[model samples]
Target: MENVCLSEELIKSQVLCAPETKVVIHGEDCSVYKIENETGEGVITRYPVFPGIEILYNDIHMTNGVSHNEAPRPNVVEINHCRVGRFECEFSRGGSIYLGEGDLAVNVMTNITNQTWFPLSHYHGITIAVDIPVAESILKQLSEVMGKGLDFDLSAIRDRLCAKNSCFVMRATDSIQHIFSELYRVPQDLKDGYFKIKVIELFLFLNSPELVNKREERQYFSRKQIDKIKEIRQYLIDNVAQHITLNELSQQFNFPLTSMKLCFKEVYGSTINGYMQAYRVQMAAKFLRETTDCVTEIALKVGYQNSSKFAELFKQFMGQPPSEYRKSFVQ
Candidate 1:
């Protein structure tokens, strides 16, 4: 594993770079990469668990998007867990899949398209990338010492999960969630050793026969449909002060109401009403913090005519009424 430097190899493979990316090496085994554009910025902190394997924490906040012209890497497999927010993965074969909160995806680096973006303009996730040959050699030695029954075949795992160069995505079950939840809270002192254990556990979990056979399929939306959905989202945000129905949106966007509803939920991880309600509450909160507007005025500005109804919804989403919430923000 020591022979293969995962960070250096990933940069060389062009799998982790964009024209906007700036790299910062923290140490021999750790690095940080930042991607910035007109919309926002993203920071990726990477740590090598072994020579051939690495873990990256991706925190991206961007409105526009980031473009990457990554070359094919048949020997690399990436496992992604979406802790929060939404991730859109477009494949070279023309369809795109979304990974919402608590979703996991495994795909060969060769299958990714040149474009990837966050549907919500913010995303937090973890990615574990393995260099097949190097990982295989190291895991073999570890397996021999651990037990003869241990299964750690990187090629077989990749083939099973990412068949025909397609990504495998599924909702994270209890077991998978347990594994990843611990990863997010690892103690600093035991970070390196803990990551090694977790990576091995993740591989073993993926290699399980039950997981391979019983995994559910996720929907893939066309690029055209995704673009339309994004446009619909932007329109809603721009017109947040107005009341727009699904039918109205359908006519305005020239998209079918049924398909728009489904695809919009899939891409943004919420139904239109649900998403907007939350968005409205979020805007109200921002106004409360940044502006001196009274509760009723702020509520009306966010499209709620009735202050009482707005207060109810705001408390439901923010766990407090507007007046109280605004007070907490006071210095």
Candidate 2:
């Protein structure tokens, strides 16, 4: 398929095509735009919550295939957090980064072209977009209100972003997660006002001296390394029943132990064992729902020898014991 460059106009004409999708305008520049797949199981909605701030919620599954899209937005900054499945992004210059669950990617678009892809055809997350000058003004007003110095240099951040080709991906801190969690729970009627407050909170957290300094020190990986790590991930998925260790994978793939550990975590946002355990549980859940197998049989199929251990892990991942989880469907 040919790669398409997405503009504001394209989002309306090409992307939001499902019959149930709708756009509501509140005022001149404030609007709520919603899009969904034909089944309504996947949806993406954007709310222009403030004059220069926009919040987008995504709960979408790309059942068709992978989508390769390019976005060219000038003088805008985007904060993308992956709360569920991971997504892969490629910069205009062949740079790539992956955002996994609880990971945040902050990027500034100033004459920059960035492309995004859904590796697993599923994503659920929130995106925050802010116009540069507007965000700067908001920060100043907030500083005055709180009586804290809140010394922030937006220009400096912009310079750094430009230096790095307008992208930085990091693990989401607890403070960041808390603010977003509160925003997610805010009542629908009060969303506009609450969004404003929460966005200010996000700015304060990002502007802290510690975070600002951390941004300067970032890891850069070669494209070759990223591709190799992705291959290793697929290998793990294919052999979920086998007990794969780091030493074994390193020797087989010819990757240094340290590089594999670091890159794997960056790409998948979890330790090797954690990622495998989560993936294994997901496979087990599929068996529980689709097949008539007993709990012990299902556990052994997904690599667990002890049925009791499998039940415990399944509860941790799926929030219910296997029997109860299956019963909910039957009842």
Candidate 3:
């Protein structure tokens, strides 16, 4: 595994303009690092609102298999929001969390080197990392304002948030989406103040009574199980035009059918069929944009023998008919 702290070095090596990828401090507590490569660009901007509280934004274009990244930090609490694409994170322990759009994952660190991979060619998101002690103080102050007592121990909360191997996934509710969307729309001039405010707002939302019970922990899988599931996923993608059955996958991977289904869902946040359908549609869309192939031929290439059915599915997934979708870009 690569050192998480200096994964930036990995990027530097691939970046066309290495010197442009550098860090710049905005104020006493905020820093921003800009990264650019041949395929795309990225910026990691961070605001240290408190002694140990940080709010960061990651806007990047990521191509598949470009690279994987890991960061090793101890006792770090991170809240990740996937605004655009999916994030597949492999924890040091044994499991992985697949965070999709409007999904949230809270990760508590313990000197673990967690690796993050982008499933698509692009990713854009924001993350807030808080230190336990720092959050304790903030929680205390917020409690006093509400005239409420601190019934739960901060450490306990920390442990629970990261319970079951250090990561939990939650759905981003409407309120949560609104908060982050507003943050994204903030004017450049007001970004500094907005960043601090949003970080506090996020904590408040997390602590709200409505959200506590709604929090759903991500399911955990052993390293071996997860690896096999990943293999299955890749195999499906590689042979997108073909139909593969659960029994076949299970027998091939030596995994129980039920376990394979559950584990695949846990890692990809979708059933195997659902994931395959999505992948096929994505591949079809790529063909529409990059190739001059007609809709019927492209449909067959992606495993769809019926052109009309292919167009219907493509419209459902891509929001327009194949011809229009292609014309929008090509014309």
Candidate 4:
């Protein structure tokens, strides 16, 4: 049987065909897929860079998770780079892993599960999917024509990074950041050509033995643990006006203190204190813009008793005092 390209397979999947999804084709080679759920919506734009190789930009802002039902194909490899926010991937084999800002993950399609979502309710990332056999042949032909040794093997890279059917994650490095940053900033007119060059450059970078050898070993949390951690997150968000200690959370949620700290950070990409601090400021900003509440009232609403301290933290996070922030939103 002829190989079906990864992009084609994804387009044929029910997830993309569901009532909540809207697909808009820009041209023969480019398309945008939008998804809406009760919580929020997500947009994915895809460009076919080369035969059997495609690039997708995923911009998701939804609290509710999306279920995937695409059958796994071992011949396909997916490369994901998390530009911002957190991606919670649940594997069919068991357990879940997270991709935070600047992180890179490479895995076979077979390892993906039916459930995948963004932990922080938002994620912006890039995905490069390669149909190994077809891509390899195309790359080889291009190399011969260009007279440059683009002899990197996609399958070998997959094997090296994803041994044992496990996803390989690499923490953000300077080189990785540089490559992706350029991709993110490419001019609209230059996108097509720029993407082709960058995608080739990306594969070459991945082919490095030194890089793969030093890949980070990320921790995976069980479903039950992830549920409890999410519960703890919701409880904290629901009661942002109150101060809660880690010890109290551990006892209240029946989760160990050490694991709670570690897993929470892993899943949400921030410590509990850090996450709450940011959340409070975000809520305060919302109130400042949407409500007539005074600074002190707004501060108290977000659990700050001292208006001065609230102003200080607000400036620290938002680059200006709350009063100024609110005024800027005014006429």
Candidate 5:
């Protein structure tokens, strides 16, 4: 509902994006998308990349389905098939969603899904699908549902995804799909606040598949994969407070330093420093968001060597200074 409309200038900027933004900035590739969600047909150009989100209307005859983005390749949803919503889709470790040909119109989120097994770093597309709906009645309901705030169990999403152990993923998806279908099935006037959020939930769940820890029970991992990841997890936990070095793994595991780096990098899907930083921040966030400890003290306790350094890192990691972060979560 917030300025969901795109301006001509914004479109121009996107269509004329630079090539090196993703590289020099360590950012993801962006694409320009202009598909209308209309009942009539049309052909949409697939300019692969993004500097900004581009959605335009093409009323000419082509393929009606080319209007909504189920995604041609993890790209933004662009199409004109009575589009009811928009959602940004992004994957860091290479994520994809296949919406069959010439725009996608789904009563359900995924008909037959093919998800990659990679560490999809958070590539958040704006829930444009939510924005496209012309019904406030439906949007209202969706806002309430999604706005109930995330059901976060303080988990940073499972670093790995498992498809065949339990049915959390499938159940969650189906549960949401049913909600969306029920809403869309209703007359538009009666659909009030129904489809978009649930649809967003369906996609978000798929995007952020869960990770199972050593202690928690869940439905992913072959024993072999678990063992390997667990080794890395344990190594991290054991050395939580120590300054990790590239060569340290060689000393501890007897692998050559390069092998250790390669293996750890491969397993964790990021540099060793990035993983440690995330873990440290996760741990630090708990204190900032839960306890009353002073920032300096908390930082030191979390293995940061200096308070100044900790404060800077805390802000970088949490989007706010430690004091502000602490205050926000203070009861």
Candidate 6:
């Protein structure tokens, strides 16, 4: 059996397809599953594709197998834009897989021939991270700049995708400054449209992308506090696989649990537990992106007792099943 990986631009903008142009896996009996958004974000529609078509937003990765169907149950919080979809499917192939995502669906191809499978489980979507106060305030400030007579706002854009700008704000306070600054300068009604998403993309492109390491002006915490945070960060780096409780961390660091939580907020811009979980998923993502290890092995490596739990958590964080992700990753 042969498996081909693809990463290509599809019919829709920002909708990425992976591994191969046409979806063909190892087997003809292997199948493609469709995940559709009947309504737009937060709006439930009877028919799933009513929301506007963006490959990732309304689309899902397709999969079917006969062996394991339960999903991981990791908590994923979203303030504005983006979703982490969770599916509990039981029967799936036990061989090499094919993966793709686009405006319509997530295509999975089997590597084996004439593979028949069952859909014993279902998938649920998890919302990603967002900073409401900040996003709203920025939206208001930007809207005031645009003269808020229109319906669309930066808040809406951030909501549509469950944007993760908290980390961005931690490093570049002004990362959003450009978007807000220029957005305020734009015509009023333009704010009604997706200038928010545009601003997000601008920030993502300028400060967040891996290829560009532009140094932006930043604000650091007080010196004494800074040292404490460095300790915490190092601890997390060293213990990414283990369970870290706030109380334990506080006792070791000599701060009251409350103070410790505040410090983590000030430094990382998210709760400690959320940070730990996100960090764990990120580490798991690294393994998925870099290794051909089975999901079970990766789950154990990331401190998950069971592979299904890891898969659910991974889906909630990255929006795809582990097998699907691995297929695209190796290719």
Q: Using TM-score as the measure, which candidate wins?
A: 1
How much lDDT does each candidate structure score? 0.83, 0.67, 0.69, 0.83, 0.38, 0.39
Question: Against the hidden reference, what TM-scores do the models get?
Answer: 0.94, 0.71, 0.74, 0.93, 0.35, 0.36
All predictions: root-mean-square deviation over Cα?
1.9, 6.2, 6.3, 2.4, 21.6, 20.8
Error of 5 at 13 (Å): 45
Kindly list the per-residue Cα lDDT of model 3 for residues 70-162, writing each as its tens digit.
Answer: 454445567788898767766556566677788887766652434555655566787776666655776677668766544334466566666
Task: State the TM-score for model 5.
Answer: 0.35
How well does model 4 score by local distance difference test?
A: 0.83
Better of 4 and 6 by TM-score: 4
Candidate 4: tens digits of C-alpha lDDT, residues 106-222: 878777655777888898888887888878998998888887668888888888888888888888889889889898888989988999899999999999978768788766678
* Clash count, one per candidate: 1, 0, 3, 0, 38, 41
Ranking by TM-score: 1, 4, 3, 2, 6, 5
How far out, in Å, is residue 106 in model 4? 0.7
- When sorted by lDDT, best at the front, the candidate numbers are 4, 1, 3, 2, 6, 5
For model 6, the stretches where C-alpha displacement exceeds 4 angstroms are 1-222
Displacement of residue 122 (Cα, Å) in model 2 is 3.7
Using lDDT, give the best candidate's number. 4
Query: How would you encode candidate 5's per-residue C-alpha lDDT over 59-149 as one tens digit per residue?
Result: 2231212112222221122221222222111222223221211223221122212221212211111112211222233434545777854
Worst 10 residues of 3 by lDDT: 8-17
Compared with the true structure, what per-residue lDDT tens digits does model 2 show for residues 1-331? Answer: 1111122322332221222446553333244555444433455566665545677776667532122343554557777788777777655566667777777767766434344445556777888866666657766777787776565656565555444455766666786688777866778888878888787777667665556455434466776887788789889988887778899999999999999988887666678888889889989989988889999999888888999999999999999999998988784
lDDT (Cα, 0-100) at 223 in candidate 1: 83
